[model samples]
Target: MNSEARNQHVGKVTHHELKQTLGTWQLWGIAVGLVISGEYFGWSYGWASAGTLGFVITAVFIAAMYTTFIFSFTELTTSIPHAGGPFAYARHAFGPTGGYLAGAATLVEFVFAPPAIALAIGAYLHVQFPGLEPKHAAMGAYLVFMALNIVGVQIAAAFELCVTLLAIFELLVFMGVVSPGFQWTNFTKGGWSGADTFSMGSFHGMFAAIPFAIWFFLAIEGVAMAAEEAKNPKRSIPIAYVTGILTLVVLAIGVMVFAGAAGDWTKLSNINDPLPQAMKFIVGEHSGWMHMLVWLGLFGLVASFHGIILGYSRQIFALARAGFLPEWLAKVHPRFKTPHRAILAGGVVGIAAIYSDELIQFGGQTLTANIVTMSVFGAIVMYIISMLALFKLRRSDPNMERPFRAPLFPFFPAFALVAAVICLATMAYFNFLVAIVFAIFLALGYVYFLLTRHQRETAPTDALLEE
Candidate 1:
């Protein structure tokens, strides 16, 4: 094969054969794995138990925003199917400056999200074992999944497929067990809170809970970054996209509505990991099934971490190829055909995050949750940029062919942008310091960009540039 043709291939996927590699089921697995991993299960239950209606309202709002955002991206990806994701799309629409910011923000999102998932997995494992230190457990989880990703795409895909199937079964079973315990009164009585006398305070508190609810929907778009790796990306992508989203929508609504009816809000509210809480309530004791469900939930989190790393590394590779990062990050291993440097970089970031949390624990603040919360703030910023990119691209490239044009054109983008702004507004209101710290990181990225510009323009950046 010529260099150009070879460059377009992934594993056995030749330029012409890329479309044949993915059947509908495999693509659906990828998308569902990306969006509705193990973590989604517990969190959905927890948020539902907190303020079921309030949380559900926020969930729907975020889903609408993300649907708009993903549809816009689908249009962009179909026209210019690059692995860098929003950064590549932004670069095409708004040039290098916009691309650089989007890439930098995404790097923060990708780097922090994996560790956060690891930390969650570690916490759940600690709950199960009570012997493991959080950092050590997190490291083990990170190492295991990082190895899976670095081995090659097929291994990663297989792991994701297994985890996705297991997670779905786990959710269905939890729903079935908990169905008998749901309480109708839980959904009706003072369903709203933090407001007195039916005042605006109640309205504000309802909106304030957007982040906790929105977290469930945020993983959906992650599938887009895997476009280049998928066989038949153009067709497989939309199929997975629609199906994965519909699945989550149904699951979220069903879990929230039924769980709200089945269990008391206060019963599930105090728990961070709600799936186990629901199982414990439903089972009434620690049975083998309960243990199995808990472990499966933890597995789901690990699988999610795996999916995030796989997709994010591709973003790193694509950005590296486009000159936004060091070219080594773009290198695909000769045998593995994977971005080894990017994977290592992702590993380093995850370790740094865990280490910093350990230091805070040593300081007696136990600030790991706070640190992860900052990452949520950073993710919100990325969401804002993505929404803005949609609007900007619509005006800049109206003529570009889009296999899936975002419904209602500019209006959808505008609505999503508004919702993103609302989420940011709430983030600032509730956690202004976290928002400030997150912004400082963005500023740091900008400084890094300035310092590296000269090198990116002149340096060859990789010794193994050819392969």
Candidate 2:
């Protein structure tokens, strides 16, 4: 081989490969950790839009969409097994532009969700120490979790598993503590967005609640990003995705229903501390159980905040490695075999977002509400692209090896695709201002992609970087 070709081969094949040290259960940890926090908060906001009963209807529909999406999305993850997740599948299906869009949307989802969760962590801490500012607590969370992620994926996943289990246990404790106070009247009062029946008013509220309903399963799909690190992607991916969705569905419904029943659901409708506050209705504000919920509740937020940091880092690394992003972000730590630079890059965005929550306001939405909607918008867009990729790959590469075919094939993917489109439309309509902000982000990112395209095409350092 010529010197140039040999150099290209070595650079592509030998340098900066991510360590594949994750197992099926560890993958499960990361999957559940990514979405468990949704049950603790966010979903309650749907109650404001749709009330308890109406939000439950919205939640059920969102749950169905997620169920089908996870089942179908697994096919792509098992087959492609790239750290870029949906970006890899879309690129293989369409091309560079498809890849850039998917990567950017996933970037928006993972990058924005953490800052929202981090601020919640800070807010939770602020209640305990009146002197501490929530943003300070939030910025501290970013520093700690980003360091954990940069250290190593295996260690990060291990910590994720421990915290995830603890979070689940604490949520269960919350439900049990509040069960006695749960009454039918309390939950049903002011339900259906205060409508006597399912009217046009109720429809408006249900559609408005789409983003918050989505919160219950928002980042569950992030498991796809971890496929490259899984000890057995083909075997572990399906197990983690399927079981993770099921776990989250049961928990999401249980937590929301129980909390609503515990008191006047209206009071819980628009707050980040619904679960804790619901427990307070039962045990009193200063009860020991309330204190436990305040302190232990943080694990739910941390699991997601930490796990998403791991996710966005891998995505940035994958996109950069493929030359869609600056190649420096692709470099893995030589000793740790983790994408350290990618982790820090994502951290910078998240911390900036954490600080900007108070500074940036739109349509009367707070940082948590606005960013939650923004992340949901990114997620639904990515979901639609991913499902399209599944259909495209099936026809384009009929000879590809099949480990886990999406069950029911066309029907499952088609259902997921349609639901995602509807959700995206309704969310955009209801959150027009945030939608505009999201679009501007994509426009600028695309401009950056166009500028970088030529350099990567002519550069042969990665002769077949990802043809």
lDDT of 1 by residue, 278-300 (tens): 66766766788777777778656
Candidate 1 stretches greater than 4 Å from native: 1-24, 37-50, 194-198, 358-368, 458-467
Q: Report residue 188 deviation for candidate 1 (angstroms).
A: 3.1
The alpha-carbon lDDT assigned to residue 310 of candidate 2 equals: 88
Worst window of 10 by summed lDDT in candidate 2: 458-467
Candidate 1's displacement at residue 16, Å, is: 19
Clashes of 1: 7
Model 2 vs. true fold: TM: 0.96
CA RMSD per model (angstroms) = 5.0, 2.0
* Per-prediction TM-score to the true structure, in the order listed: 0.87, 0.96
